[model samples]
Target: MLERRGVMVSGAAAVCFYEVCPTVDQYCQLRLIAGLSEKAKEAAEMALPKTVFAVSGYHCCDLVAMGRIVGDGACHLQLCDIAVHPRLQRQGLGREVVLRLTAWLDKNLPPSAEVSLIAKGASNLLYAQYGFVPTAPAAISMCRRC
Candidate 1:
């Protein structure tokens, strides 16, 4: 897992994470983040051509199994779209990606840099291992359906 948010690269066998969007339209179609279609599109368009870091070990040469970091460098970084194909799950690829990204954060971000992520399901355990404690003391997280 290369940790530079938006830094793209390809290759690996079992570690490929999908390259989601080349445009906002594609991102909305894929992620379907509720009211986020328009906003996500704008962001994706701005961030496209940006190298979203990924990992892979599938031996195929695509970054099809990996995770990504999205945000402005330095201040705010959000870990997003972390996926390892269903076939690749339980093989520690996800953990590897998180660890790699954490290591990159440690090396690059300033001590005050704020790194964040929204985990899906039980995956919070993995993020916890990387020091992503819940934001409880600050505020409870919530999502509303439209």
Candidate 2:
């Protein structure tokens, strides 16, 4: 069993999962969550190359879910691009995905490793419940494409 944020998860398994396509459908769902344009071709081009996606196929048995963790293995990790289909929302699947990913990180990343993520809307509260704190007072965040 895995526990986080007053939730318990079991009976699910995640392998050494990786996906290159991750489906345009799934991509569009995640883009909606992030408040990005679901019709933006540039967003699709930008997201496809950077995502390392995982999905669940146990209960509802579909590729209607996804998440990603991108970073150097030793010191930094960023959890991003998490999305469950609209029909599956509020069914505890998102928490399950985050739990599995953090479990993977705990086992694989170094002891002092720091994981970062850009949470969408109230999702920041979800991540905070998993021990993610604001990177404030010490440093601010910035991004650029190059």
Candidate 3:
């Protein structure tokens, strides 16, 4: 695993045990706590089931961070909904979440599988650390929201 800040995680992130996927309620709540906007509960319900792989970090029996890999696992995949609770920020939990999802992709997906994520602001730096780079000048990222 890639170390965070040249140091192995030894705090909440290190202690948290990750599940392959969290319950829908857990997924939504984690996102909300991270200051992400809330969506209809039904939307969350539908989305959670579609994830190809997900990782939820738990510390002291409470869910503290989360991320999900969605899209076609074989040919293309997108990482989304990565968040760590405000109280849990800076504990490496966010990195741990990404690490888990990427590790799963590396092990399970074929080499031909293409992975991408739309990272905003400073989060780009974090994603870059995991080998995600800008496709700028080649391909641009575009999105449509409902």
What Cα-based lDDT does every candidate model obtain? 0.58, 0.60, 0.78
Angstrom error at residue 96, model 1: 0.8
- Write the residue-wise lDDT of candidate 2 on 1-146 in tens digits: 21112222323432222333455655665557645445466666676666443433222323444577777656777887677656556666677677767777777777898888876678887787778888878977788755
| Model 2: per-residue Cα lDDT at residue 113 | 85
Where model 3 places Cα greater than 4 Å from the true spot, the runs are 1-14
Candidate 2 residue pairs in backbone clash: none
How many pairs of residues in model 1 come into backbone collision? 22
Q: List the lowest-lDDT window of 10 residues for candidate 3.
A: 1-10
What's the candidate order when arranged by decreasing lDDT?
3, 2, 1
TM-score of 3: 0.86
Cα misplacement distance, residue 26 of candidate 2 (Å): 3.9
lDDT of 3 by residue, 76-140 (tens): 89999898878768777778778878888889999889999988879998999898999999999
Assess every candidate by TM-score: 0.63, 0.65, 0.86
